[model samples]
Target: MTTMQLEIQAIAAVVAAACALPGVFLVLRRTAMLSDAISHTVLLGIVLAYFWVQDLASPALILGAAATGLLTVWLVELLVGTRLVKEDAAIGLVFPVLFSVAVILISRYARGVHLDVDAVLLGELAFAPFERLTLLGLDLPTALWVMGGILLLNLVVIGLFFKELKLATFDAGLAAALGFAPALVHYGLMALVSVTAVGAFDAVGSILVVALMITPAATAYLLTDDLRAMLGWSVGIGVASAISGYWLARALDGNIAGAMASMTGIFFVVGLLFAPERGLVAVAQRRMRQRWEFAQTLLAVHLLQHEGLPENRVESRVDHLVEHIRWQPVYAEQVIRYAERKGVVRRREGRLYLTDDGRRLAEQMVARA
Candidate 1:
């Protein structure tokens, strides 16, 4: 509606898209929690860099944060390599120490500066528009420029190294064998993630950075199996979340970053419940169909087995099938009805008989078994 509102939403959207790009690989690689780890530990890098430069606007801060992110990954991998602790445990052990050190340094030395814990965890997007940058003779929010550049960087890197990243992610051993240098690609990805996290940190904060980095990618994973499609879906969902979250925050008069994160969760829940092949509802329906089909198969097989036997008369009786097949009367009746509709069985004189198709079906199932 207004210029400031548009600027803020644009910044949020760019940040969301930037974070979502590397998130796809993170989700697939099962290293999603690393985003959370990097988001927090990068604060220490910022503090140390700031102490060196005595300037908050220095690019050294971004470089320092990226290095810290790589360090976090290296430490976690080192711990995991020992086979003593698992990956999750390693991350839990490493990030807190680094983040805590950052907190301590901020409280002790940078107390008079704007580097506070609240801003790092809960950034104010509404204020983002005030930090303007003049780029190519156009004035715009600094967050927009920063996140947009990061988004472009992500696109170029992913495009150029898509195959390498994919192979390394799905099968690192094969990738290395094929001379892809999976370890190098892995650290390269981590470096990109680090830069993206720090770029978004000023606009969305650390918590929302993790959310945008993981949630959209995870939600897209439920909706599709193709990696390229997943990346597109993730970016789309992230952008939608950013725009919708702005409106939600406006409606509730709430925090924009938190609202955006909440929207990502909402999208994920929707995908989890209703995705075509992998959703809960679809899975339940598939199971229910299988149950009915299985019951029908059993009924057909039972009728075929006793077709001409002396016990056929009693065993084929509709009422007697409950005891013969150990089915409840109600369940037996339902199975019989379903089989009849499928032209697999016929009923006459209270007896059940398999039709031509049902006999063929039973014979095949028996042969397979």
Candidate 2:
């Protein structure tokens, strides 16, 4: 692969992982729209920071962006707590006000500065390679380093606070009762999300950033109930989507970030259809098998219920089933075979008798079902 393509892959990989991290908690807390809200309001932070720093590449940018995210969360919380504004209304109010302010700022002052909607909402990863850093005369794309740093920071923070995060997400009241400050953990995560968003925004833009973060995690959720497995699978899905999207974009000459997000979306569809145990196909097959077994078991029980005596039932077996139960001969034989295997019936002196386990189970089924 060319250096640019490699750098794009690396950048996407890191960005996708970061998006997935916050995405897990966001999805669980039912605050997924918060990411969307934060993504839009980030424009205000970028504009405000740019107005002060006069440059996009500065520490103030991330700090300002994180502050804006916190402000968005604060506003949402305040409105929600008031009961005057509904949840959706708070979300609706936060994004428009902040985004409008951002637009007004750019229109008023930065029109000639090239900080347009495209740069704010959808970043230019094509030019990422050209924007590089030299380490010992070996040049590296700025985005790759920025995203790698963000990934490492997220890893450390997540690792250190995994228990608290899980507790805060699953049971906030219990978490608080346990002397852990769920609020503090939540605020810290919000700040981390904002910082990750700002970093990713500069590389992949808002739409792809949110897509990469949420889709993989959402897809993984369908496959596993275990958090550790979900986290692992989510990250794996993100990386795979990044790689596949890169190749697809290459073949079609398309936008890399957009393609990556599309790939993640597709991954979700595939998982929904094919995941085992809970997946559509698997569940259907299991239900079909279960229904067949249930029908056969019911037939055996019906025959045994009619026979009552073991000797009469076994002696009259093949003819008795066909006569009493309207089941075809072949179906009767199939049920007989199954019952014998299940220890539900046994042949003794050319007679069939229900075993202890079989009698108890059949009795319970008849009584309740």
Candidate 3:
């Protein structure tokens, strides 16, 4: 690989990792859409910051974007607090106005300027290496430092407040009852998400920022029940998506950010189909096994019910199962064989009889019901 391709991959990986850290909690909280809202609204923040400072490279631009992201969340919460709109509705209402206003400003006043809407929506990662930052006598891509700093900040903050974050995410009522201030934790997470979004805006664009943030974490959720395991899996999945998507883009001569987003979707599909306990295939297998076992239990119960009754004895033969239970021929045969193997029923002459063990089990099953 060329140096540029390697650098782009490295930047994408770092951005993915940074976004995925808080994204786990976002997914758990069902607030994944907030990433989309904050990412888009942050553009307004960047534009306003640019107008004030007349400089795109200033740190104040990031601060403005971060603050704008926080404002978006607060506005949504405020609208929700008014009880006139739901959370999703509030987000939908707020972000479009902010984003459209920014777009209008860009077209009206900054049309001939370097800032372009297409660049903000879909970043040009190939040119990322050209924007260099010289740090400690080594020149590196600016996105690498920006994303790396955000990644470190997310790790430290999440590590320090892991317990509180967990409690706030899963059980806000309990957290509030215990004086943990769930509201503060929620807003803190929003703040971090906004900062992460801004950090990634230059490399992956605002659109893919939400993809890298939410998709890997969601895929990890399907694979594990443990939060720590989910976090680890999410990081691994994000890095894997970055690396694999880089190669995919190279192969197809396609958009790298779009390829990375597509890879995240592929990972989620794999989890949905192949996760050990919760996957669709495993779930179907479990349901089928349950039906088979229940069918065998029904056969045993039927045999026990007809035992010691001369009138019903003629109806207790194995052939009567299809007529009595309405089971398909193949299914009835399978259930009968299973019952015999379990010693729940015995065949004597042409009749089926329940064993002593079978009678006891049938009675217990009835009692439990």
Candidate 4:
């Protein structure tokens, strides 16, 4: 409604979208937790750079954060390569040490500065609009300019290297065999992620940055299998979360960053429950169908085996299935009705007989078995 409100929402949306771009690959590559590790460890870069330059606003801080992000990744990978610890264990081991060192440095040397762990971890987006930057003769929130630029950078990089990223992401061995340096692409992506995290973490905080990076991409992954569609969906979900989260915070008079993070979880739960093919409901329904179909196949095979045998009448009687095949009476009735509807079996004079198609299906199943 108000200008400040609009600016806050815009900044949040841009940050969310920017984070979501690389997040798609992170989710696809099964490295989503790296976002969390990088988000925390990058603080060490900022602290070190600030110590070196004694300036909070220096460009060196960004570079420092990016390098620290890459360092985090390299350290984790190095640990994993040794097989001494798994990827999760490596991330757990590396980020805490880096983040802890940064915290100690801030408390000891930078105690008088505005760089505090709480501010970096849980930023206040309501204050974001007050920090203005003049860009191209237009005054806007600094977060808007920074996150917007990062968003554009992500778009260009991902567009130019879409195929390479995709190939490397899905199959690194094949990508390397085809002359695409997957390792280079991987580090490049990590650098971009680090930059984006640094840009976003200042305004939205590390918690929201991690939430935006992983949640939207994960939610989109549940909704679609195509990489491009997943990217689009992830961006859309992020923007939606940002806008909706602003309103939620307004309604509850709560923290905007935390509200935005909560919205991402809400969207993910919705996707998990309702996504067309991969959702929990769909999976449950599919399993139920498979169970019924399998039961019908067993019924057909049983009938086919008893057809023309001395025990044909005894085994083929509809009620006899409960005892002969160990099916419950109620379940046996449901299976018979389902098979009848599918034309797999027919009940004639209370006896079950397999149709021609049912017999063929049974023979095929038998051959496979």
lDDT of each residue in 190-244, candidate 3, tens digit only: 9999899988888889999999999999999989999999999999999999889
Compared with the true structure, all predictions reach lDDT values of 0.94, 0.82, 0.90, 0.94
Q: After superposition, how far is residue 366 of candidate 4 from its true place, in Å?
A: 4.9
TM-score of each: 0.95, 0.87, 0.92, 0.91
Ranking by lDDT: 1, 4, 3, 2
C-alpha root-mean-square deviation, each candidate: 1.7, 3.5, 2.3, 2.3
The worst-scoring run of ten residues by lDDT in candidate 1 lies at: 321-330
Better of 1 and 3 by lDDT: 1
1-369: candidate 1 lDDT, tens digit per residue: 999999999999999999999999999999999999999999999999999998997889999999999999999999999999998999999999999999999999998898888898888899999988999999998889888999999999999999999999999999999999988999999999999999999888998899999999999999999999999999999999999999999999999999999999999999999999999999999999899999999888888888899999898899898777788988888888989999999999898888999999999999999
- As for candidate 2, its clashing pairs are 314-352
Collision pairs in model 3: none
For 44-99, candidate 4 gives per-residue lDDT tens digits of 99999999999987779989999999999999999999998988999999999999
lDDT of 2: 0.82
Which sections of candidate 3 miss by over 4 Å?
306-316, 338-363
TM-score of 4: 0.91
Q: Give the Å error, residue 165, model 3.
A: 0.5
Per-residue lDDT over 38-84 for candidate 2, one digit per residue giving the tens place of the 0 to 100 score: 88888789889988999978889888988999999999999999999
Task: Give Cα distance to truth, residue 71, candidate 1, Å.
Answer: 1.4
